[model samples]
Target: DPSHIAGKREYLYEISQKAFDMGMEGLMIESHYNPSLALSDANQQLTPADLSKLLDKLVIRYQYANNPEFENQLELLRNRIDSIDSELLEILASRAEIVRQIGKYKKEHNVTALQINRWSQLMENRIKLGEKLNLSEVLIKTFFQLIHEDSVRMQTEIMNS
Candidate 1:
């Protein structure tokens, strides 16, 4: 879903301008017909007619400019990223099942729901590996935090009996 802070058109405009200045081709705006009837993002979705009007206004001000080489490079990078993203999703699904197994085992062993120390160690090791692979530390940390939180919740549910 696309999101921008509301009641801050100036801020959003500045951000969009910065992206253009940084060589982005254009913005990918989400538009829908009868946004009020949307199942999701009812508040954010714009009617198709309104969106068209907005795009017309924006197109007059924004020029389409890009280095020819940039498109090829971007396509190559996108392909590589898509491949890795598929693998990552598979691995995450496997990890979720493994967490479920761990929850069951912990129940049998009468262990406490969460092993925070072990989770901390796991995160530290993962961040180290991520660093070796050139991933941003902040991104790695945030990913692990969400995964750990969800895994703990799963474990908690199993332990509650």
Candidate 2:
């Protein structure tokens, strides 16, 4: 991400701090004895002294806290997340089954698996619904595109079989 930083050296420390806060165990920081004389990525390359100072300033957090109440609340929230994930997997399986049935129907009717107009409509509807649910449009579009691709692949397989 040195290129993305675009000579803003301060951002590197901020990003490293954020990564540490996000539970990253280690960071591969570029350093040199004389960064000003470095051939590549000189802007991002911190001198050894600066690197040491940056490392000292960074606060690494442990994954688990020692507080029992905090741990209990975290466990409860994690359990809820696990339950939701299970439900999501079940829903995806059901959707895949329905897609399989649709594939069979398409094969019987001699219809194409990919209908451009249908895909366009589906994307529009799904994007709007996702936005209403406070989800990012890009995330919804990418997620649905992946699902649609898999659905099309399934139908194509059925057609070939």
Candidate 3:
């Protein structure tokens, strides 16, 4: 998570400490050099050096806890969770990029930006598929809502551009 411009490191350290005290295994943070050049979250991206410093502190604190089995379990779970999250993010990014392309095509062809009927059909099919896969209807609906909203926004941006 991002914090105010100044004291971000202190703020994050406090947060990490609190989380640790509350029995959290760890945290996930984003970092970049020359954060000003970042495409997303430019203002919040920490420098590599700063990120390393934070990690060092976290490592020391974690080791001081002296629960090797707990640490190992946390590491394994975190790695697997991160792997799944990365794959999901990749898929979403690819989908968004394709939506942008579709918007460009629509603009060049003078097509309308939205097709409500098609979207409805897509949602219905996805819901059925989710059910077949043993997913809750509510979860399926919520997921599709988020995906559809993002797709629409992406396509709209391309069309306007």
Candidate 4:
């Protein structure tokens, strides 16, 4: 983070303030008696007095303020997220069922469950679609890999049985 901050003390102060305002419990700011002579991360290390000033400027925001309007809005947003999560679970369940059927078909036909070419093609298409939807490639790949692993495991079990 210091490398990213690149000796910008003002940016660090702003970021720290933002984090505090976002209801972070605590922060670990590096302070030294003399920052210029500090052995490591000299660029990021603030003098004790400077650190104290930064701390004083930080406004701590409470997670649960006694404001009815804010609480109500927060509750609404949380409810929406819960609804989306429920729908996501339902979709995953349906996908799992379809995968099980595919596993059965593969078992009956003596076909391998872990088809590398198909997986590679699926990943390429999925990454493209994910990028279009503004999703990270890492997230898409990891999610699909987990699903594929489960599908392979299920198919292997069916074949063994």
Candidate 5:
């Protein structure tokens, strides 16, 4: 598919460079002793000599941890990300706990999980807040729908159990 270009060789080189840029190990290139005489897909085949030249032109960089400065910066950033991820999980868990309690209360009152008016109110209020926070309405809707679905499933399980 990548070979579907004017210059197949150049396409391969470009693809190789992009792969390297995007933290890929390497590209799987088809090499032939003689490209023109190749039996199958000759157009997409690279001569060994050409492959060697392309390899030479490429600058393969080490992983981020190779340099101490880079490693330190990456570690700091990753640690911050880890902390943020932990906080996100904690928030979700807290929400789940509340949903669990709600399930119990609804059961006690002999109410079903599908509280349409309550769901609509929540969606409307949260969507407004999400808009104020500069979030896309579509994104907010999707996220809340997923959370609502999660709550419904968990509540159903709790109710039945």
Candidate 6:
């Protein structure tokens, strides 16, 4: 994300760990001779000494692609994910219902689906909340934009039909 000063580095490390754990094909890191005096992003830059220390601490996990235990655990996780997906679908459906109601009101009042001011407020508020919740601002913004686009599309259809 590299967007926020506080969360960026921590979030970077976290995703790097996950990527390696999930058996990513390649990994790269930047290390400087002296991070404190680095030319750019000094705070995020790691000295070779610091990088070595971190590399020493990291445990390169096995892929476990064919391990029976991994398979079993994967199955259990998939089941849990299935459950969560069901719940998420229900929630999204409810949101869609609300969107439809809003569309109906907007249509009756001859209002446009696009509300730039409300969208701007949502972008700011949701992005701040997402950062507080340890989510990348880009991630939250992209997600909101997607849902907002879909809502707009459906609302437009409702108004037209």
RMSD of 5: 6.2
| Candidate 2 per-residue C-alpha lDDT over 1-161 given as tens digits, one digit per residue, 9 for 90 to 100 | 43244365567778888887888777877888998898887777888888889889988888889999999999999999999999999999999999999999999999999999999999999999999999999999999999999999999999889
Regions of model 5 farther than 4 Å from truth: 1-68
- Name the candidate, 1 or 6, with the larger TM-score value: 6
TM-score of each: 0.56, 0.78, 0.54, 0.72, 0.55, 0.59
Better model by lDDT: candidate 2 vs candidate 5: 2
Q: What tens-digit string does per-residue lDDT give for candidate 5 at 1-161?
A: 33444246657887777778778886777789998898876887789998889889887866565688988998899999999999999999999999999999888888998899999999999999999999999999999999999999989888888
The C-alpha RMSD in Å for every predicted model, in order, reads 10.4, 3.4, 13.9, 4.2, 6.2, 6.9
Best prediction by TM-score? 2
Superior by TM-score: candidate 1 or candidate 4: 4
Better of 2 and 6 by lDDT: 2
Worst 10 residues of 2 by lDDT: 1-10
Candidate 1 ranges with C-alpha deviation above 4 Å: 1-73
Question: How much is 13 displaced in model 4, in angstroms?
Answer: 6.4
Q: What TM-score number comes out for model 2? A: 0.78
Residue 22 displacement in candidate 2 (angstroms): 4.0
Candidate 2 segments whose C-alpha is farther than 4 A from its true place = 1-10, 31-35, 47-59
Of the two candidates 1 and 5, the one with more favorable lDDT, higher being better, is 5
Supply the global lDDT for candidate 5.
0.85
- Model 1 residue 151 CA deviation in Å: 0.8
lDDT of 1 by residue, 14-98 (tens): 4555566666676654556776676765665566776665555552233443777877887899999999999999999999999
lDDT of each: 0.73, 0.87, 0.77, 0.84, 0.85, 0.79
> In candidate 3, how many Å is residue 152 off?
1.1
Segments of candidate 3 deviating more than 4 angstroms: 1-71
Compared with the true structure, the alpha-carbon lDDT of candidate 1 equals: 0.73
Question: How much does candidate 1 score in TM-score?
Answer: 0.56
Stronger candidate by TM-score (3 vs 4) = 4
Best by lDDT: 2
